[model samples]
Target: MKRFALIFLFTFLLSPKIYSQRCGGGILTFNIYTLNGEDIKEFDYEIFPVSKELLQKNLYEKVVNEQNMNNSDYPLFKSVETSGRIIGKVFVDQIIDNNNPKLNAKLQELLDTSAITQKGTITSTLLFSTRENQSFPIVLKISNGDREVYILGNYFGNCDREASLVWGDKVLKLE
Candidate 1:
C-alpha cells in the first residue's frame, strides 16, 4: 500500500507540468504583428491567443516561432508574444483606428471575448481589427462549429479603408 501511494503521488505531481501546455512541432512561444515593433504602443493591430491543441491537430493557417522572428530580424513589428504554449503568435498590427470612438467600443468587446474564451485546444479563435474613423468593429467572434475565425475587416483580404494593409498610421496606403 505504501509503494502504491508513492507511485500515485509521483504521477499526479508530474502530470500537470508535462501536460499543462506545449507547442506542436517545436513551434511553441512565438508572436505575430502588424506594426512591426517590440511593444504595444507602437502597434496598430490586435492579438490572437492561439492554442497548442490547435497546432497538435494541424489546424492553423500559419505557424511561427521566436527563432523565426529573430532570425528574420524584421524591424517594423510593433509587439510580439506567444499565443500560448503552442507555436502561435499574437502580433499588434497597423489597422487600429485611434480616431474613432465606436471602434473603441468594439475593440473593448473583442478584448473581453478573447480574455474569457481561451481554453484547451483553442480550436476556435478570433482576430480583431478596427479603423481609426469607423463606427463599428469589422470583425466579430462567432462559433463556426469547430474552428474560430476573425469575422470582420476584409472578408477576402485586408481592406484598406477598413483595415490597413500596413498596421501603422504611417504605412503606405494600398493602391
Candidate 2:
C-alpha cells in the first residue's frame, strides 16, 4: 500500500509538467473585418491543445522537409520549450452593412458545433495586424512565452467569406 501510494503521488506531481508541452484550454476570439477596417463578425473557439514542440516539428516538416524549402534554414524550425503554448485571434476579409446579432448568434452556434467536434484555460485575446507584405494573407501567430511563430500556410484556403475552425493542425471550413 505504501509503495502504491508513493507511485501515485509521484505520477500526479509530474503529470502537469509532462503535459505542459502543448497549448489548449483557452477561448480564442476571432474578429473579422473588411479591408476598410470595419469589424463585421466575431466568434470564439477552443481547439484541442497540441504539444507546442510537436506543432513546431510538424510545421517545420511541412515547410521544409515536405515543401523542399531546405535551401536555407527556415525561420520556423527553431525549438519550442516543453512549456510551449499559444493564443489565437483571427480576422477575415469581408464587409457587412452592420453587425447583426442574429447572424452573430448563428456564427457562434457554428463555432460551438465546430469546437464540440475538436476540443483550454486562456483569457483575454489580443488583436493586431502588420503590413500585408510582411504577413500571410491569413496569419495565425502562436507565441510561446519565449518565441513567436507565425504559422505559414493557407489555413484559410477555401474558407473565403466563410468561417474557419482550426483544431490543432486540422483546418475546417465552416460554411
Most lDDT-accurate candidate: 2
Query: Could you tally the backbone clashes for each prediction?
Result: 20, 5
Model 2: per-residue lDDT, tens digit, 46-85? 3222232343354444445666444334433211111112
Q: Name the runs in model 1 displaced over 4 angstroms.
A: 1-96, 116-175
Model 1 has a clash total of 20
How accurate locally is residue 65 in candidate 2, as Cα lDDT from 0 to 100?
Answer: 66
True-structure RMSD for candidate 2: 16.4
C-alpha TM-score for every candidate: 0.18, 0.22
Q: Name the runs in model 2 displaced over 4 angstroms.
A: 1-34, 65-73, 77-175
Top TM-score prediction, candidate number: 2
Question: What digit string (tens of lDDT, one per residue) describes model 1 on residues 105-152?
Answer: 544564553343222222222242322222222222222243222322
Q: Candidate 2: lDDT of 83?
A: 13
Q: What TM-score should be assigned to candidate 1?
A: 0.18
**What lDDT does each candidate get?**
0.30, 0.31
Q: How accurate is candidate 1 locally (lDDT)?
A: 0.30
